[model samples]
Target: MKNIIKTILLSVAVLGMSSCSEDKILDLKPVNNILSPDAFTTPTLIESYMNGVYNAAAIGQYNSTGANGGRGYVWGAAYVEQGECRGEDVVNMATFYDLTYSSTFDATSANNVYYWVDGYRLINRCNLMIEGTTDAVAKGIITKAAGDDYIGQCKFLRAITHLELLTYFARPYNDTPGATHAGIPYRVVGVNTQAEIDSETVKPRNTVADCYTKILADLNDAETLITTGNSTAFASRVVGRASKWAAIAFKTRLYLQKRDWANVIVEGNKLTGAFALTADPYAPFQNTTGRNTSNSESIFSIQHAATSNPGVNAALASMLKDRALVCISPIIWRDADWKTDDKRREEGKFIYTAAGIKYTNKYTDVTNRTDAAPVIRYAEVVLNMAEAQARLSNSAPALTLLNSVRNRSLANPFPTAGNPVGQAYTAASFATDADLVKAILKERRIEFLQEGRRWTDIHRLQKDPIASVATNGVPAKVASAATPPTAAFVLGNSFAITTPVAAIPYDDFRFLWPIPQIEMNTNPGLGQNPGWN
Candidate 1:
């Protein structure tokens, strides 16, 4: 925490100069005196500071300064690769993500160490924004409404970062009766001075339940404070910035992870009329035309541009499309449940086939690498509600919500007299609630194929009582060096591989990532996860 804290304080002094070329929210000018009293006095200076925080959280320090600097929450970094490659749906074909793919990472692994460092760095920046905005309001530098909006954005970033850390560094919420397992430190105070850094160094990790409580508290605050009418500055920046609907949509994700079915529905209901799925599956990902902002499906996204994106090395297009470091694994690709005529499997759309190898084209900017990193989407919200309703035995509404996303990709979504049984799911389609839930989960895998969401579902459902969809641990996958079929891939064909990596059971020590070695050395109070030492 000391090293991470020091970085945060140092970054605050140069916040204005760290602006990246991004959407209007991130187009900031340099502020000569950022640390002076006049820093938060005007909208321009305040927005410049906010832009720095968003840049740090979105793009990170990817300038080759250090190993972890290349990875951030978005831009095909730790959150994207680690979240997908660690699961079974995607195959790792290169050395970049091998440790994460094979579950062989240790405390000192670059991915493990820097993910923790960058996450905490972003958290502290949010803290600084929160504290700075409160002071601004007190000193009459900004209005109460404006201050609340800034603080709301800070809280939203803080809550999401903490949750991301918990997903990797700690056990699932259901691992214990009350989620009493060790959780990551939820920092709310900004550390600027030497005294603050020293004080933050000795703080201990919170329990998983307590961490979730704090996350929800911050989100609840954000829900109330982040509104379109509060300030003119915020109303115009709704596309890229957090809004009331984004906060509600995020709550659905958190509640789904916790298995809070009723709460999931409650938060999901608020987004009913606010957003809808796009008619085409690829509409949300048309990066060249800025569809990520214009599309109705996107709730909140981290916008990227030609100049400000994680370059070829770490961009989503580079990793998943152009370089093909990670390919769509045959495991999900060969599943018969995914209809043969599904539009998502169509070449040149979401997927592309070349040299008999299949790659995801979800991020299409192979050269420019300017694809927007989707944080939350309306489809996810619909699926969240669908799963929650299925869990509570409300089958009709569940199927309706499920088809809202799944139907768009199917060749024939609705039933007709000529084709009585169309592709859309019916009430009779599932034998039981467990069956319905399983179908919804499968839809999530296909809908969010290469968007780095598979591992999150795998993580939260590891301890599910339902045996069908509950994952034991990391499932077996095609070997890293497994060869693709020599012939062109055919729909529903058995593309067998001779070598398959075995599964790691739930009880394995490697199930959870170890605390970074540097954090352990710097902060004596912090303890590592089991089997790391």
Candidate 2:
């Protein structure tokens, strides 16, 4: 196991490359000790390593992140399924209590170690690609333009992967905008040698500010080199690889997390002319025929193939549709103002089980988990702009942007074309900016449920969760009503249930997970997050 880890971590650059049917050049070990110099000298070899980086992306499943010898790195969809369970919008209905929601979960037992390892492991591969490309260009092994392209791809992945780590492990950037709060160590160089790995082992966390600075630098460099033309040039090769637009869309997320409202609007505006909302909002997820991006609402998404499934449990369908273990929160689902007409809440969406509990039918593919996982979407960018404008006190514009999303979903009626009436609101509907902002937030809750972003939205906003894990229940039909009935998870003795309200304080240490004990034990320099010790 140790030898395998060493090989995966240290020698990722020199892994053998061969073209596959999927256009991915895989790491086939034809020879025992290939030299990095020989492997990374050509465009084909460098691209092979880049494909490996893409291959390392997790599909939001327990065992999918390649930690503890897990299988296959496909796309960012893995993050959504795994992340949705952490937020308040969804409930894990099975006996399994995900560590993300467990108050008593300890540092030693902290889950998602795969998240940390998979991220850095992939970043290390990117570092190798970046370093190898630079050296290849300097030695005239590859063209300067080729080197730049490779570097841009590496940087884009590096930035987003680092940001993912920060989202899960480190304190939120807004917790302390300055370099005071500890963020994950900003690792740029590949751990090529044993000494370099040892040095990295002892390095402390960088400040949140430092990490963000590094992220922005990488994004800026990537955007400068990876223009739309460059992406168009490579269109015939791969459709979903990160491009200039992906970088811009990611900045909207990054800026929102940091509370940089102005920049959020600035970055979001760049996307307005490029992509339009899906004619049918569900078409992006409903595309079962193939992995084509035509008529996609996503600015960037991880394309999954039917032949290469990310397991039932790891797939989004398992949470709600196929396995049907997790369900929408009864309380939130029954909310009076959750946009009844919105296409997201069609009748079959929440199927009734024999237990009188309703499970989501959002994930339709039980046979093959080949659905495209969204990383960034056109609607999210609109919301980002709306939120930024609201924060900047541009109320009229914010409401207009917010209403645009409301209107889009209204226009994209599903299951018999406008069976349920859609709701729309204007600036006159809200008395103040806060009201409008809260309305937008609520819209997101309804819009993005089970997409794995609710938890991040709650934490980044520093809002207290409305309920906790102990407060569990499922929504049931109440006499052919439009919405489902809400029940509570009862305690002992009386055999009675009460609607429970468990609050996770905004400052709760559980908001930031402890660094897994395995990581701490293996590396002497690694430190645990506060309140975990």
Q: Measured by TM-score, how close is model 2 to the native structure? A: 0.81
Q: Show how many residue pairs clash in every candidate, following the order shown.
A: 0, 2
**Residue-by-residue lDDT tens digits, candidate 2, 1-533:** 11222422211221111112212212222122334555576667766666655656633223323321233222455467556656656665554434554344676542455456556667776787788788888989788887787788779888987887787677677666364788887888775554555566656778889999999999988877664333332233234677777788889989988889999999988876566666555655555423324444566666666644456545555445666666666556666665555566655532334355655554566777666666667788889888889888899889888877776666332334455433567656788877777788877777676776776676576531322221222112111112223343111223222234245554567667676655565453556787876
C-alpha RMSD values across all candidates: 5.5, 7.6
Q: Against the unseen true structure, what C-alpha lDDT does each candidate score?
A: 0.75, 0.61
Instruction: Estimate, for each residue in 1-533, the C-alpha lDDT of model 1 and write its tens digit.
Output: 22222334111211211222212111111123255244577877887778767776666653234322355543235587788988888888877788888888897787766677667767877887788789888988888998898899889888988888888899989999999999988898786555565566667889999999999999999999986522223224355677777888889999999999999999999877677788888888875436466677888777766766666667787788888888888778877788888999988878877677888888888877677778888999999999999999999999999998999999987878987889888888888999899999999999998887888888899879763436578777778745556442566455565336777887888988888766776564677787877
Q: Please, what is the TM-score per model?
A: 0.90, 0.81
- The residue pairs found clashing in candidate 1 are none
Candidate 1 Cα RMSD (Å): 5.5
Q: Residue 487: error of model 2 in Å?
A: 7.1
Error of 2 at 373 (Å): 1.5
- Top model number, TM-score: 1
- Deviation from native of the Cα of residue 279 in model 2, angstroms: 2.3
Off by over 4 Å in 1: 1-5, 9-38, 62-69, 74-77, 228-237, 288-291, 467-471, 481-483, 486-488, 497-499
